[model samples]
Target: MKRTRINKYGIVACAILLSLSKVTLAVDNVTPISIPMVANAQVFADFTDDIPAVLNYFTSSTKDEIIDFYNQSFGESIFQEKNESALR
Candidate 1:
């Protein structure tokens, strides 16, 4: 009986911790891409025009953006160097 009570208390404590640990995410506001429209691109045009935006959505760039902000705060030259190195 004591063992069962201890188990019950342990479960209750676990449940409380689990509930507290949950983080509610805000709704994803990014619009979904229309594959059909993208497929309809002109025959001469590149098919990957919209691919960058789609790919960038999955890659969180908050760190890069912050770095860029600090770099730009210094001057355009440093920012340009950073962009050039990224291209390389």
Candidate 2:
């Protein structure tokens, strides 16, 4: 009996994948052109004072209620609006 030949397509696919991986590694080795954190560096430390106890009242409540209230109120402003559906 004659021996079967290996598939050429599978070998070609593997070679292509290997070459792509090398290109990816070469790109990653380059230094980032600029520092990324400049905009985000000052984001923290906005609240210097102690967090108020009132903030805890929010966490104690059920999640759905809190989510509904939050989505309805557009931040703190919505609490003043009289929407019975949102209250439910």
Candidate 3:
């Protein structure tokens, strides 16, 4: 009986360690991406934990002004009408 209890405890400990390791690996695998924001923009919502993170905000800046800011930030003219003028 004592040996059986010891085996059960060992199995439980191994399971716990395996689960913890999986969580650690998952956290490590999530490479954080930096997103540029418009200056003086009012952020209404931000959901960074989701796959393809989302950010919602409003700015008084004109559409062209916003596009220019992102273009300069990313060092490319990435904002276009085809992508709804959004950075992918």
Best by lDDT: 3
- Lowest lDDT sum, 10 consecutive residues, model 3, at 78-87
The alpha-carbon lDDT assigned to residue 41 of candidate 2 equals 34
| Candidate 3 wrongly placed segments (more than 4 Å) | 1-17, 24-33, 49-51, 78-88
Worst 10 residues of 2 by lDDT: 49-58
Candidate 2: TM-score?
A: 0.35
Query: RMSD to the native, candidate 2?
Result: 14.6
Q: Model 1 RMSD to the real structure?
A: 12.5
Model 2, span 1-88: residue lDDT tens? 9998999999999999999999989867764332122221333323223233112121344645656666665545434545789667
Better of 2 and 3 by TM-score: 3
lDDT of 1 by residue, 1-88 (tens): 3554367888899998777666322223334444222222333333343334322222234646645654666544432334567566
Best by TM-score: 3
Task: Name the lDDT value of residue 66 in candidate 1.
Answer: 45
User: Cα lDDT for residue 12, model 1?
Assistant: 91
How does model 3 fare in lDDT? 0.79
Instruction: Please provide the root mean square deviation of candidate 3 (C-alpha atoms, Å).
Output: 5.3
**TM-score, one value per model:** 0.21, 0.35, 0.56
Total clashes for model 2: 0
